[model samples]
Target: MTRKAAEPSRRQPGPRRDKEPLHCIAACGREVDIGTCVIRWDQPGSLVCPNPRGRSACTRHDPRLNDAPTLPFSRYRIHNPDQAYEELKKTVHQFVLHYDVCWTSRHCHQLLADSPFKGSHFYLDLDGTVYQTCDLYWKTNTAPADDGLGNERAVHVEMANLSWQARAEESGLHLLQTDAYRKTDAGWLLNLPAGRRQELRLQSFQPLAARAYGDRGYFSRKINGRTVRMWDFTEAQYAALIRLCRGVHELLPRVRLQVPWDPEQRRTPLDRLPGFSRFEGILGHAHVQGGNKNKGIKRKYDPGSAFDWGRLRRALSR
Candidate 1:
């Protein structure tokens, strides 16, 4: 983004009105109540003073009126992305990761730019393309329901895709057969033999992180009387997630690191989560609200069961 320097204003001050109070609309931090002043509004919606021919001279002179300071385009850094991470160190406390469960990155970007969800700091596509949306210093209005955990104090990241099979393909990984079965009216639908299912149960199931940011509902859906839960994420996406998290941590040294699948802290109340404090480190949206039966509210379960916490922890540690 291009940067422009502030310039001097050439407009003269308006004539002083002794009986009337004078006020400046340029936000130049000048007060005009006690005595006569030259401040006046020349036109509607215009910040500069008109400076009428016979009016009193303006007591305040600001150079910025001539040329306002220019911020980077969209107040964001896309080329040197690490600079953006460095810029966020001061104000950001939490780093939240979300999956844009859409089919493609284009759809994800369009959806996020719309109302309510328009505040994410970065977007990482399946191909590892990172797009900086808002300025690092700007606070987005994401996650308002979480009180102190909203866009004001946190940086949000979005990854795109849907389901484990798709995620594995995108990441060049293979999905192993499992005995897990979905119970439907037609009877039990098994992905593998019952004996194999038991063996697979001992292992973790990894799915791609595919789900819209706004979809915070139950992961399971009833299809033809069958309960089906889908989840996924690509290896490239996971690697990008690790890099992103590490970059954020390095920039903001005080931020604590956290993953959603904390076995010891299972079923922890939302209010009691780590986000209540500014010192709390990085955490997942799932950590804030996971599962359909979370306390009283039916919270979201995105970055759902398929996300591999073990891998994420190992990667961050490295």
Candidate 2:
């Protein structure tokens, strides 16, 4: 069961009122003083004064208006991939990866824009080009409530593509179409190949790349009274991912190569952990989805059973 990406919110631009002086357009309903307020356009075509007083502003309007000194990776990295890489080297402790599981890059961007969740530092398009959306060093709202790992400390990467079910049908991959597993108390535990699991574990780097689903779980859609978990990353995607990981490792030598999941234990080590700020490595969303002691369960499987970990490992090794 695959779900279509939500259409981007299209709000009609408010009429420009030049006669009125600029005020704080936020819901706070405060009149901004030009002498102290920092004026900027937060939403499209909406000029707003984020700071009404001389004090700090709210993040709901702009995330960058905080009092903290700017780090090297503070700027958006969309067009400057090299600069983004260099900046991330100085401060990034963890590199998290996620599949857009949506349609096009435009759709992915729109989804992120409308979502309450903060966008990832970089986005990998189907053509293998990596685009930066946010600062690598900035903490994001990707983590669950009170889970601790978020934009403040981790770097996130999103890969734009379709979900596993749609991709499998289009590509004629029968293995992914099989319904061999059942939903359990823990979640939908997938019976993936051991060889593939080993491959994923081996390719992981330190601190692990956290999957977005780790905290919130997998997004599922029901079809014909059956629940389906979808995730399909292409071979080209894997190649690009390997290159990205290698580049990250070259810059941050202290980062380890390891998955956060404990295959023997069949669970994530960070599930109940207080925070991920001190830990450094690469982990997937699946490793963090169930939460500590499986307290807050959302998704059970992601990067799904068909993700080609062996191929990724082989490519990285070469």
Candidate 3:
């Protein structure tokens, strides 16, 4: 899906009409107050989704011939913001998270823009800035899940993390000759290119893993029948993500600020869930897209082994 940028408003970027333009998550073309900073699609410093997909089947909210998943904003029609928001909240219930396998959110945005039809509603940066690329009313073809209906009911965030690709041995995609993170005195820190360092939203920030596994500074575990290893998210990322979760919960009441948990296993299962679509709340893309035992679809491992599910769960509990 390809998304045309939002039509430029005659008014300048500052102080958009109706929206407070600060610390909010957008829905139905308007901003709803959220916990952290969110750069909206219409704002000047926004990473607008290159291709925004419109689901034609959902006529309750929009019925303007919006079957095209790659329709430009101008082609899509929204009759009423009040009605569309209510319908959108009723229809959407899941908040799917992803590791973008990029060095930074800016880098992730560039890759998304280069892609033919790939897009996400939000992008969580290493420095803790959340970029809202498109309104939650639109669907991004980020994950089809197993039933191929995950995108239909969920909003998605592409957080910047290299995943297994950080290690040269495990990184087949990028062909990295060395590990992305350097063993600094402070612990493990993602080493970005000199030029790219200046691109971060937080100029003084250093992307360091909030926690380390053993002495390796990364964690390895079996997820989706495969060994997935990655460094923990930065303290800032986890903090920002928690706020984002709360913010999502605020905007879409059905999307609770909680992760998946198994009472029998006594741990959060890091694999494709059996009743994925039915389970509502915050979840990883891996939880939705990790194909079955028979292997009809390719397995997915992301928001990988290193993510702190327990911390997220504990925070959401409060």
Candidate 4:
């Protein structure tokens, strides 16, 4: 089953998308249905994931792929659904979450597309439009947890959120003169520049964080030995994410509808997991990586402090 996506909010979008959901992703001549609105690599105006090193069982972070031609989605190298599904099921066990630290999914994709090798399997936009850059049969170089073998067992989603960058003092990569979110009569709206307004599927969309903490309209907490302060994800993102999680679980059972919960703490832990590499569920990048320079894994903290892990847990439970 699939949910046919409604039209973009304003002017017609380019590279035309399937007005009707194909309900499946194409790869190696096989397609698996995922019941959601996903802009695929084959779609017009797609922000395609780059550098397919190889299939699920054959990936190993090949530098050579940086220069390799990204094959069309319709012509993925694998040609057998049974073999592809079996390999994917065994290889992918965790769904890794991230806050893209960008204004929208298009911005996030621009950064990835410019990089020699960085890419994500999915991008959850501010308006909750999910962009599937490539087939789930391939591995993306999004998060390489402590064991350095994380890519082998995880698929990734780069949800749009500036994270700590929402604040001027904490902003780094995408420096901001002031806070990225502005408080309005309506709510705490992200100050998306007018120039980038068209990036969203909903031109009139107000990118408000679903929840906020106190007067500042952002959440401040410690995660992975550092202070992270940011606004919550949008309500639309939460709803779409839950649906996406359900679809992912249906398609790949091992990547269960669960997050990193600390039973004693009575909430999800916002730090690297001790059994990080062994866990089998949806989790934030912070849950698996506490940067070790010697080990070559930079510290990661994403799907940050403002993310509602408990809310996600409750929603998934149903």
Candidate 5:
């Protein structure tokens, strides 16, 4: 039996195991077979690995692995973060460029040429109070205060607002409001015929400018530098738009609608409306009424704000 000292058996350096999906264990430096690993230890020290009960290593080598499986996202995850970031960055850069450098409405037009979102949000708060209202509107109507043009264009806008809200509904945009306002003692006063509370309806997206008074429309928003023609209906169009907005609202419930905050004022009547949560964003029209001391109105866009290069991206992608 001693003839030719029996050759010694070679030992493997790492953990011994059959071929399997490779996963670095948290405790051992040695690679253990996936089908065999049974022990759980924190850092890879000489802790016991259960599979063979012999495998062991230190924490330095193998880190914990995330076991979560991959799954598809739902429509609620509609806004692509990566893509939205790109758009936000581009719009922000352009805004910086034209912010003070290009001091004209036309300058703003060129600045927002690549905006991802249609409009910028503006907040209006009454003085001496927390009350605020926010509205999201595309930057149209950027002409120099209409040059005191005929009819001042407010009545035309009023008609347009009524029509546009109806159209937006038909086109599948559901505006939502919050019920929190109803529970307040000030809620009953909201029953007024012409208070801001009445404007709370998602339908009243636009409102008459202070100077224009009772003439402007809710949806008659301004854009870069021109009167962007809304989906003005011929009665037939308005009816169709109503149905569409309701349908779209039903389909995409996440696109919530709500009142904008008015930090300066202590009270906000718009908060009392129903279904305010459906609105996704806001429209800034504080300047539309001539209160913008900075004259931001000069920087607005036209009705066809979509004609700009920025919106073209979305339209083209679709």
Candidate 6:
């Protein structure tokens, strides 16, 4: 009732080479040097194409040779897995080769350096003072009883003093501290601007007031043929006063100011007294003007002097 199907016969492969340096093709009988050829197919543990060219062979025995699969879709190709993988890695490396290219332009190098991820840094010395945004006084706040002193009695200078000290420290400003003015056992010494010591030496004339008043701070001398005033300190004037003296008088050009020190013993309150009474011997005046020399130069007074309107304005601005 049913026709029987024929059974297929199994084929065993030929003998293998014994220590041979080269191989030969099965169909074409072409000799393939070991260096130029590799194994292709296999059947039951025996090689089908004993030798294979780098390229696929011409179609004679290959049943699907005319329609062979290509790289993107191929499944049956006998490619050397090691060589194929190496070639893939080399292609990727060449594609990314620009990473190793040295930066020759200054701007490009700077751009690379500026990346925040790289972690680099530097610093600068920025200068100048930050002024208060608004004016403050006792009249503005009704915390105290009214006195004839008006706003002066209500004024608390401590806040201003504290603010200045804080800002100076935070900003790295070269402000002199109150402690620097306190009297020490050391002689009345302070820092001087460079070369001012030389200027002091060159203008060697002593002020007559120094001798007449018996004040260690008075140097009422003439410099560059111009009238000048000088003062001696009692350690409370602060060290910065010393530099200010040198800067205004000897270092900078054509700067004149009230004598920073006095032959007379003085305090900040001494100036507020009547006739400047308690300040009598403690305070001496210098006629800071160009006499025969700087007749055109004007006198500059200290901050709290009766004649110091300009100084008051400067303080208010600060």
Better of 3 and 4 by TM-score: 3
- What lDDT tens digits, residue by residue, belong to model 6 across residues 134-202? 111001111111121111111111000111111222323336342211222443232332332232212
Model 1: how far is 254 from its true place, Å? Answer: 2.7
Quantify all predictions' global Cα lDDT against the true fold.
0.42, 0.41, 0.80, 0.78, 0.20, 0.20
Which pairs in model 4 have colliding backbones?
15-44, 28-78, 291-299
Model 4, residue 282: what's the lDDT? Answer: 95
TM-score for every candidate vs. truth?
A: 0.48, 0.47, 0.88, 0.87, 0.17, 0.15
Candidate 4 global CA lDDT score: 0.78
What is the lDDT for 50 in model 1?
12
Candidate 3 residue lDDT tens string, 1-318: 112123211223465566554566767755455556677776667888877776543553445434444556665555676677778778888999899998888898899888777889999888888899877787887887888777889999999899999998999987889999877889899987777777787877899998998788899999888998898788988998888887777777789777899999988999888889987899998899877555465578889999999999999998
lDDT of 2 by residue, 61-137 (tens): 23453324332332322333344334444455566666665443344566666654445545555444454433233
What tens-digit string does per-residue lDDT give for candidate 4 at 17-54? 64666344433334445555677787665778865545
- Model 6 scores a C-alpha lDDT of 0.20
Task: Output the number of the TM-score-best candidate.
Answer: 3
N/CA/C clash count, model 5: 73
Ranking of candidates on TM-score, top first: 3, 4, 1, 2, 5, 6
Q: What local lDDT does model 2 show for residue 313?
A: 45
How many pairs in model 6 have backbone atoms within 3 A of each other, for residues 3 or more apart or on separate chains, i.e. clashes? 7
- Flag regions of model 4 displaced more than 4 Å: 1-19, 22-35, 55-76
Model 4 residue 285 CA deviation in Å: 0.3
Clashes of each: 16, 33, 6, 3, 73, 7
Scored by lDDT, model 2 comes in at: 0.41
